[model samples]
Every structure is written in C-alpha cells, then in structure tokens.
Target: MTRPQHFGWFLARGFGPQGWGYPSLDWDYDWTRPEVYQEAARTLEQAGFDLVIIEDSPSLGSPETIDLRVRHAFGGPKHDPLLLAPYLFQATRHLGVVPTVNPAASLPYTSARQFATLHHLSGHRLGLNVVTDTGSARHFSDAPQLGHDEAYDRAEEWLDGIRSLWHSWDDGALVADRATDVYADGSRLRPVAHRGRHYAFDGPLNALPFTDGEPAIVSPGGSGRGLGFAGANSDVQLALAPLHEKSVRDYRARVHEAAVAKGRRPEDITILFAIQPVITSSSEEADRIVAASARPDDAALQQIARKQSSDLETDLTALDLDRPLDLSIFGAHVSRGSIQRLIGDRGEDAPLRAHLTALARAGRLSDRTGFVGTADEFADLVEELGDWGNDGVLLWGDFHPVTLHRTLDELVPILRRRGLLRREYADGGLQANLRSF
Candidate 1:
C-alpha cells in the first residue's frame, strides 16, 4: 500500500481557536458573527485539509482569564453543532465534518437517526467523535448521575445498539416492488435488541444508511472505563498530550495497547495527538508572534486558552518549581486518576508542581504537538510522522482553531513543491482524498 500522508485538523472555537486556518472565537467581541466563521471555513476547505470537527462542551467551571503563567482555552459553538454540520459541509467541498458528542449526554436512538440522516445529506462525509465524559454523570440532566462504571457499561450496549441500527437496512432496502405491492423489503430489514444494566433498546433504525458502513467512528478519548468503550468501538484514537516526541509516542502506544488488549486489530485504530498549530515563514517568526518571557505558550500565548482554569495554575506558580508538585491540590479540578499516571510518566523526583509549571510554561500541552518550523521543516515533519507511527495529527493554533493563514503562505507551498501535501484538492469529500492515497 502507498504510505499515507499523516495529518488532520481540529477546532474548538473554545480552545486554541485562532490556530486553525480560519476565524477564531472572539469571546469579548463576536463569536456569533456567522459570516466571519463561514469565511474561515472556506479558507480551510481551500487548504485541502482532511477534516474540520466542531467541538462542544456545556460547562465552564473555571474563569476565562489568563495570567502570564497559564490559561485554559475553551471557546466553542454557542449553538447545536449537529445542526451546523450539513451547512459547514455544504459551504465547502472535501472537508469532512466531525462533530464531538458526549455519548451519555445524548440519547443514542435519537443520535443514531440524526447521524444516519447526516450521513445521507453529506454523501457519507460525516464522522463521529464519541466522547464518554467521566467528569460528572449525565444520567440526570436535571437528571441523576450514573456511576462511572455504569455509564461505560451503558456506552457498550448503546454502541452495539446504534451500530446494529446503522447497519440494519441493506442497500436498496426501500424497494418499489410493485408486483409484491410492498414499498420496502420487509425481510431485508432487521431489529437489534441489546439488554444491559443501565439501559436497553432494540429496533431497526428508522432511516436507511447512505454510507456502506457506520460513519468512520472516532473515539474522542477516555481512561479506565472509557478505554474499553473506545477499544471495542473506535476507529480513530484522540488525545491531548505534551508536544514533545516522547509524549506523542506514549499516547500512541497506550492507545495501541488498548486496541490490542481487546481482540481488535490495532491497525484499525489510528492515534491522533492534538496540537495547537503555530506556523510561520521561519521558526523565529512563530516565536515572535507570542512574544513572552518563556516560549509564548501555544494556546496560552493567545487570548482564549483561559476559558477554564485548572487548579494547578495559581498554586503551582506560587510554589517553588524547585520544590515539587503536591497532587493534593487537585482536590476539585481533578481526581486521583489524573495523578498516578502523571507521576508514573514523569518519575518520582519530578514533582506535580514541576509538571504543572511545565504545562503552564508551554501552552502547547494538549494538541501542542504540530508543525513548529518553516513550511519546509513542517512538511518534512509531517512526512517523518508517517514514517514514525502516527496515523495523523489533529492541529489547532493560538487564538483561532486555524493554522492556515501562515500555513498557506509558508507551508503548503513547500509541501506542494516536495509532492507531499496536495497543491490542489481532488474533487470529493476528505475521505475520498485519504482513501485514494
């Protein structure tokens, strides 16, 4: 098989909003500016990217303020992202539309139908980002909380139910069999029944599928109970890790382990580490954009990385980095599950305080791993990643979810010269471009 080019794009107008190739959120100004957002979408479509996913979240536990030390960039769509998919997909061609949906937060039966409908409308250009939220149970909206384990258990059964529904009707299930006087083929349609502790449902999906199979499923990332859900059902691996090579390798390896632990083919799961992109004519120019005492933090260097504050921000800065981190400070912002992994990854001498400081010093923490060099260097980096082990990268940039304004001027041209990245997009959706290669 021809080696695949390994790179994709991610956008959450809330976090690293400006790094993408389009207009980012202006929390103080106008994120509601539809025309501005539309223009940005056009820019990305013209760039020949693989996909543009809309990220969503309902809570804002922390303030959107940035100190010189650190910030939480979480800017997102003010409206329902699902409603916007067909519009975004239609406004431009070849850009796949990925919409992040917390499985537990929404009803699967309804989602199954909506996604099936989306698949039809987009001509099979839709992809799903399945995020199983572990923070709080959504059993009750105004509802009660389901235990974490129970929630995962629900996801397992729910995923099975949805898949069965998606695949229920075969091609041409809607037959105009005049002789039989039947509008549809009853024998071809089947109902799926799945029973579990939290929920149970069974039925043939109400709609016919446009895609041959389920829209390529992407695991939005989770741990403990969540990993099992991802391994069994996901096709793409999603994560936010430090940009350093070691961090990328570690996440890819962990996700691969999850895939292998189950009976699933590990190759079916592609590891995608998120990076807030920072492109420039030269590496120095990129640095200049964020003029800071330290490396202008990736998203922190921008205005929005501060949509929420992790508890470690202030305390870690206050404590002596020379000392060490006290994991106890995570009482509210995080749980112990977030600690053991950090300790194991960083080693005993490396204290939690140091880790927090490092993250603050480098805002490129989540999705921090991306093209940081001149166009030529970045193009080579993308090529190198394919040689290494990455399936592709999910890129963002500071202040905006776009990385293009600089990329088009600096990187794309170089990539084209090298015959690596495309100079002109082929006529079709993002998948047609990807699968052909």
Candidate 2:
C-alpha cells in the first residue's frame, strides 16, 4: 500500500530567465513579470503541491568567470525572490512560497520585520529557505567573509537573533481592549538584546505576534554541519542523495539521529529528496532517449561543458578534452563537492572527454532507479520510496507553467491513483499542510 507524500517545486534557476534554454521560451512570457510565476503557482496548488522554493544566488562570480555565468543566462541577472513571494501568495491561498534568503545580505532585524510582514500578509504561508552562502558577502557592506564551517556558525547566530525578535512580544502584548480604545499593551512586549559573534541587534519587533505559528524553516544542506542545523532548526530539509531504498533509509536515519540528539522527534522535520524525472510519452520513447545518450558526440559534449562551466565558474569549453582536467583550474572558492560531482568515480588521470561522456550517459526506468521513464514507471519509483518510509519528494524545475505541466500533467493523476499524492490540502497555511499527513 502506498502512502500519501508531500510535494514541492524547486525554482532551480532562481529568478533568472525562465524558459531561456528550453523551447518554451517561444511562449514569450516576460520573465521579469509575475504573471508567469503566478500561473505556475496556481497550477501547483491545483495539483496539491505544498510549497514552492525559489533558489537565489546574489553574486555572478568573480570578474574572470562572469562571462561563463551569464553567457547562457545560467547564473546571473536574477531579481530578488523575496520580492516575488507576495505575488505568489496573492495568487494562491494554501501553497507556501519560500524565497531564498541569505543572512550575510540582510541584517537580522530587517529580515525579522520583513518576513513577519509577509507571514501575516500570506496568512502564515511564508517560509524561509535559509542559505549560508559566503561568496556573496562582498556585495554587502562590512560583511565578513568566512570559511565553510564558520559560515554555518554565522548563520546559526543570525537565525538565533531573528527568532529572538520574533518571540520578543509576550503572550499579552496585543491586548486590544475595545472599551479603553487600546490597540496593544506596550508593557507586555519584551526587549530583545542579542550580542553574538556574527551579529548584534536589539529589537522588540514592531511586527505583530504570529497567531498560527512562525514561518516554517526550510534548509538545504547535506554536510554534517548542515544536517545539524536542519535537525536543530528546520521544519523541512531539502535533501539530495542516491534514490535507492537503503540509501534513503540511511540518510533519513542520519537526519533522525541528529534531530534526536537535539531533543526533537524524527517526525518534526520533513525530508523531501530532490528528484528531476525525465517524463517520456512511452517506454519505447524512453528507451530511444536513453539509447541516444549512450554515445555523446562533440556537440553534446560541448553543451555539457557549458553547463558545468557555469556551475564551477570555470570555462571548461576552452580546455583540451583529450587531456586530464587540471583540478587546480578551479578557483579556491569553488565548492569541493561540485568538483567531486563533476569528476564522479572517474580516475584522477581520466581525460575530460571521459568525464563528459559519463555525464551524458542516461539510464533506463526498468532498472527501477534512474529517472528516465514514462509516467507509470515513475509512479512505480514513488511507490517504492513510500515503502521505504520516505517523507516526500521535491520535483525540481523552473517556475514556469510549461515546466510544471510537462512534469506533473501525466504523473500527477497516476500518483493520485496509487494514493501517493494528495487530492486536497488542509487549512492553517504551510506548516499545517506539511503536518496534515
């Protein structure tokens, strides 16, 4: 028997050009306008998705790599996702809108007040996709640049300060006495004075107290420190790992262990693994697609290089494909994990062509592991994960109507039939929707 699972959409490109690289760009919806995303949000709500997480990165990389970042519109020219959340809220009532926010870019007091206002306006449908990106610190004045672990430390302090401000108002702070014409009891507000290594602030937040609950905390970090942070503070963990049953169980156990260490129940946090399934029309078509990718030609290799270049902030297309890639070509700031992902299990002496060809190879759905499949095959994978005690799966793509429909159109009804997807949402905003199952 399959159990109902939570679903979400990851706006993988941030607020950048939607449909730019895809054929859907011909649809001609202005990426700067909100209508495209609004339509997408409504579609997600109708499909019973619980939330939409908008990805953001404030910087385009150093001057040397700016060309690689934006040449394909892969990384730069992004508007603020936080500014776009309200439009999504105005468009849908139950689906949560989580915009990526970095502590290094904004002060604690400002984040608390702004988030509090959106939380109220959205009726507690706001969520924060907290990120501790150290690369963009230079964009903010007087922001300190820290190492990886240190960055998480600063984020911890920043979140602590924000929570303190959110809780500054006491239980009786809002005593609206009708006869006395008093709107609030100022005496009941508690002052927040936070002095931490990364931040210093004082606030009895001017924003009103939350009637339902504070905005849900969503985090995407797989590191030890990242998992620890999720265990301690997050309500949703954006997870990524191999989709095998044992792998899923092991990963959930690690997260549960971390939560238990922090005195939190395992059920307190929803672990939604990130998956991007390639939906095909038929098994034969899926087989053809997988077969076509087995031997990538030079053109296919170049396209792969372009994407990898944007991600690593290094121009890989210019490198000699016949020679072993010089790992030192990557800058000091490039994430080690990104480099490892590009290399995979390939040997250190392997040529660049070998790496790109391995990446271009596709797997079949009959294997019950890889993502290339028809809707029914995809449903089989979802049901198998449910049997493994999976919490949910976050489908990744651009926040465009075409992308939403392309992925969910056939897959949705199939999952619904298997009792793997929700048909209706319960009230109480994002948290309630998450806890409904």
Candidate 3:
C-alpha cells in the first residue's frame, strides 16, 4: 500500500490576487473579496488538504521608494490574513486555517489570547504560523534591529511566555453553576509571571480555556537558529530547501536531530517541503508551459525587479543591469539565499543585467526545481519526496483558475486512487488531524 501524505497551500498571494504583476494567464481573479478565499478553503477541504497558511507582512519596503512597492502590490496593500479565519472556519469543517503571527512585534500576551480565542471559536481548528520580525527594521520603530541569532533567542522566550499565559487557566476552570451562581472556580486560575531576557509578561489571560489544548504551531525558516526554534516549539515546519531529494533528506535529518536533542520525538514534528507543480495533459505540454513562463515581457521584468529589491533589501532600479553585479551595493543586509538560488554557481561575479534579464524571461528562479508533468506523473513525484521522509508538500503554484480547479477535481482523484491522499477527514480538530499521520 502507498503511504498517505499531508498537503497544504502556501497562500502567500492571498488566494489568487488579480493583476498581481505576473505574466498574462488564462484567468483573472479578483482577490479583494473574502468569498474567493472562502471558496478556495472549501475546495481544499473537499480535496483533503491538511491546512492553508495565510502569510502577512504588514509594512511595505523602505519609505524612500514606496512607488514601486505600491505599483507591484508585493509589500503594499495587504488585508490582515487573520480577518479571513472566521470566514474560512464558517465555510469548512476539516480544513485547518493558519495565520502567520510575528512574535517580536506582537506582544506574547496578545498573541496567546488571540490564538486561544480563535481555537475555541473555530471548533479547535486553528494553527499559528509564528514569525520573527527581523527584516524591515523601519516597521518596528520602538526597538533596534536584531541579528538572526538574537531574534531566535527572543522568539524562544516569547513562545515560552505565550505558552505560560495559555496555561494560566486550567482546563476545568469554567463552571457555569446556576444554583450556586459560580461562573468559574477561582482555585483553578493563576496569574502567569515571566521576566525573560527579551520579554516580560505577568497575567492570567482574560479569556476562557481553549477547547483543544493549543493551536498547532508552525514555523518557516531554513537557518540554523530558525531550525532550532522550530524544533523546540513548532508542531509543523515549512522546509523551503531546493526540491532535490538529497537536499531535502539532509534538511530533514537536521530537524529530526534538533528535535531529538530537545527531548522530543522526531516523528512528532511534521516537515513539509514547499513545491510548485506544473501540471498538464502530457510531459511535452508541461515543458511547453514551463518554457513559456521563462519569457517574461518588460512589464513582467519591472515586477520581478520590485520583488527582488524587497527581498534583498536594496533598490534594484538604480543598478546597471547590463554591468557586472556590484556586491558592495547590497551592503550587509541582503538575502544571501535569494541571490544564491538565483545565479547558482555563477555567484556574485555574474553580470547583474543578465540575472535580471533571465529572471524576467524565466519568471521564477526555481523553474527547474518544481515538478513538471501530468497529474499522474506529478503524483509519482509526491510519493518520491515522501520516500525521502517528507511529511508532505506545501503547494505554492502560480496556477491559473482552471489549472487550480483541475488540480482539485482531477489530480486529487489520482492520488486518492493510489492511496496517497485522504478520502475523508479524521474525527478530530486540526492538531489531531495533523498528528494522525
């Protein structure tokens, strides 16, 4: 029998936003309405996806150059992903809703209360994708920017404080006694006090107890400190390594080892490799599609430039694209991984203009890394990744509406027949469903 695997959609684009600076496709999606996201959630639920993560970055790039940011809408106008939770929860029964929350910016007490409240309201089907606010230093005016290691240090303490606040009220603390007029047992509640290196919180949370223990914690980071934070606290970790089998296996081993060292079982943590599948009727058609995506127009190049500038934390508009890449221009705050993934072995010595030209023409840096084939062939790829010990895959495709619809309607059936995907949800909430595997 084939082993079943978990599935999730990386809703980074807020459930298919229209005119979002991508090459022209077959469909136009209006993402401003919540119904679009609701429909997507329902479709995923029907397809037996494990969860849908809502990514949010509140601040646009540097104020000095906000025009490109607004024009591209990459970091500009973003609806708070948390606002869509209730809509999704009301629309679907089994699909888990995960909204990214930053620990460094938001207070631990507020996060603890909000997430716990969401857990109760959503019938114990909530997940928290925790993030450390390290980039965009201008956004956090109150505090100085922190190094990667220090950011994780603060996040560790922040998570601990949040957990303490969650436990302030015991499970059986609520007692609505009409005859005695006692709403809650006072003995079961206590204030949480923590004075850590980075955070200080003292509180018995002003909310009732959570229905399902606590929301499942999700983390996304590939750095050593990032893996450490995830291994210690996260129930699910997004593995964004190159989609090579050896690379994924090596990363999984590191995560498992870290969890084991922390006195936690390796199997208890789920690692989902992020992938974008280019599905078509045949291998030749898929190749044609991939080839087309590589030839982006002038408008497309501008969008890529804007997005790259944000990722590297430097304006690329000023760079002479035709000249050799000036490594000094990036300063000390550039995203090393982003640049490495782009140019590969060419490194910083490659021509700057050639890189942008290639990016605009190719559309994405990882065009070759993603699986490209028919639905059945793509299923084979998913199973192969499972063999490398991945819990499942986080789908991040730039799929057209028709393509996305077919993925749910056609591709999922293939996986179901192969016994690699679930036909129905297990009898429990998000945490139980996630840990079932």
| Structural similarity to truth (TM-score) of each candidate | 0.76, 0.97, 0.89
Candidate that would win on TM-score: 2
lDDT of each: 0.58, 0.90, 0.75
- Candidate 3: TM-score? 0.89
Candidate 2 C-alpha lDDT tens digits along 77-166:
899999999999999989999999998999999999999999999999999999887777788866457887888888889888999999
Task: Sort the candidates on lDDT, descending order.
Answer: 2, 3, 1
Off by over 4 Å in 3: 15-30, 176-181, 291-303, 331-334, 353-369, 397-403
* Worst ten in a row by lDDT for model 2: 135-144
Clashing pairs in 2: none
Model 3: per-residue Cα lDDT over 100-163, one tens digit each:
8777667889888888888888888999888775665557566777776787788888889988
lDDT of 3: 0.75
- Give residue 265's lDDT in candidate 1 (0 to 100): 79
- Candidate closer to the true structure by lDDT (higher is better), 1 or 2: 2
Show model 1 residue runs off by greater than 4 Å: 1-4, 14-30, 62-77, 136-139, 142-150, 170-172, 177-182, 222-227, 241-254, 260-263, 283-292, 295-325, 329-357, 360-371, 398-403, 423-434
